[model samples]
Target: MCIVKKFYVADSHFGHERIIEMCARPFSSVDEMDETLIANWNAVVGDDDIVYHLGDFAMNLADEDRVRAIFNWLRGRKFLILGNHDYKRVNQLHPTLARLEWMATPTTSLETTDGGHRVYLSHYAHRTWPGQHKGAFHFYGHSHGNCPPIGRSRDVGVDLPDVAFRPRTFDELTKGMIE
Candidate 1:
């Protein structure tokens, strides 16, 4: 049996041009950024893989259809972990985006299928989460690399060079977690 992989990334901020300058992203244009992000995503994320987007998916695009189309281009079963940029309620999202059937509820906490370790997912960095003290890992975004890990926690935002503008598997995010 083949095992489906799960990946994580945050604050892609897809259509936001200023983000490139703000985050010092290497791309030369917003189109380049968007294309590269999508390419990088599809390169690693198989059709059967799972992707957890920590939020700030796309912004500055007034067209809901374009926004939905952008999302539709990516391969995988995607989940959202609502960030400040994503609006407070799912109903408030653009009609098209809101209409898409996400794989699960935005709120999430789970056990790693690979390690059996508890994991919490969010868009904002939390000083403490449900299992923080007990060795559970917390992954979040929004600071764009400003916030350091409190312990087994860190920013999974796409702007971070280490993440390379693509979703990361649990193992990739936790490789150094053992030390």
Candidate 2:
């Protein structure tokens, strides 16, 4: 298994100009979009931090080598939870699996040491899982227009609120969930 860290960011959704324009908001051009993402990323993330790009990394890539190189330039470790837009050709360019760390699959589960559960990193929120309403948080991203549902339950982890989109600090993520 990879060396997991206490904090991570979900869904950078880099390199897709159309989706970035539509979903990220206020990005007049792709360059502006890249700048916004990079700035937000650098602000919250430190060199030792780990980030989880939970899908839709690149739709049309001219080169994967350049992509991995960019990841390196970003200055932190990355773990990708591949989304629908990721193609096999893009996977071939990376050194490891389709995603940087995690396998490129439709749905997977990640467990915190204390046993809280979260699901659906890269895709959109279609409909909330009825049974999961009282169980673990089900995180998805297909419906870019909607926000991930955060239901209340006794069993739910404490940090569930901050787990959604928008920038969050590493300390905020770990403090709420870990101890």
Candidate 3:
């Protein structure tokens, strides 16, 4: 039997160097930002897991081949959820990218396992969106300006000073937030 390992990936925003600086304005130096992002990704991701890229994988695909080649080198089964910036060029290499609208709020149920479904992946938070769905934890990245809101069953993955919060695991996410 094939055992499946699970992992979560999000907005890498690769290629643009000094993204921390560039986001303040625009890229200036020739430094390769994607390389650092890739390294950070590899540091956390394991070989036997899946990576879910939320969106904004890069500023532009001027170097599509190099970007895709690096992504292909990463360790994991990558699933791309199209974000606002994801254009046709980026999709060319990662053809399996999924439409964000199709994903159910709370979480997307891939298997028929008994317990509650976990980790709703999205590019942005849906404070109103998930409230309507049944109980399921959601994970999303976007609004880097805001911190991960502690909801009953939700975790935001954007790392910002004001929004800097501990990322929840599948179990913690599904179980709900602590009061």
Candidate 4:
């Protein structure tokens, strides 16, 4: 039997050079940022783990090949909720990025294996979502820690304030919110 761990993260911006300055990331360079992110992610996530990436996986990429390498470097079974940059921000999926197996385009929802808690995943924040009134949890990226989470929602973006720039468990993300 295998116990699969699940983690969530977003807005990694792997190939984006200016994101380090724009998001005030701690790294001095894009390579350092990417390497650190990859290292942090693999430190917690395992090959059999599942990772829910809310969006903005990469930016300013010359090609998807680099993104592919990042993907290969990380350890996990990855899923994506397309963010503006993940699909090139033109309101359409980039031709090159279309080849990756994101498992879903647009948005998706799932019930946690442990508690059967419903989690709504999206690239952009939502004022209201399906099952919102019924206590469904929402996870999203794109604000880079600007927008605060309302109710059971949270921003899992890499640049979220006070975060360690890595994938985190649902419990870790929602630690103080549940009470």
RMSD of each: 2.2, 6.7, 6.4, 2.1
Poorest 10 consecutive residues by lDDT, candidate 3: 105-114
- Tens digit per residue, CA lDDT, model 3, 61-126: 666665667667676666655565565553343332222222232132222222345345676666
User: Would you list the clashing residue pairs of candidate 2?
Assistant: 54-122, 123-140, 123-141, 123-142, 124-141, 124-142, 124-143
Model 1 agreement with the true structure over 34-135: per-residue lDDT tens digits: 999999999999888899898888886466776788889998999988777776355365444456668875543433444677888888888998778888
Model 4 scores a TM of 0.90
- How many times do residue backbones clash in model 3? 4
Estimate, for each residue in 1-179, the C-alpha lDDT of model 2 and write its tens digit. Answer: 44434344444555556764465455676656556666656665666655555455554455566455455556455555445555455444333234344323323324322134443333444354434554444444344534534552111111234543333434454344332
Alpha carbon lDDT of each predicted model: 0.82, 0.46, 0.49, 0.79
Per model, state how many residue pairs clash. Answer: 0, 7, 4, 0
Pairs in clash, predicted candidate 3: 15-34, 120-138, 120-139, 147-163
**Cα error of candidate 4 at position 57, Å:** 0.5
Candidate 4 residue 40 C-alpha distance from true site, Å: 0.6
Off by over 4 Å in 1: 88-91, 108-114
State how far residue 59 of model 3 sits from its true place (Å): 2.5
Task: List TM-score per model, in order.
Answer: 0.90, 0.59, 0.63, 0.90
lDDT of 4 by residue, 17-92 (tens): 9998888898888899999999999999988988988777887655778877787888988887777786554666
- C-alpha lDDT of residue 137 in model 1: 89
Return model 4's CA RMSD, one decimal. 2.1
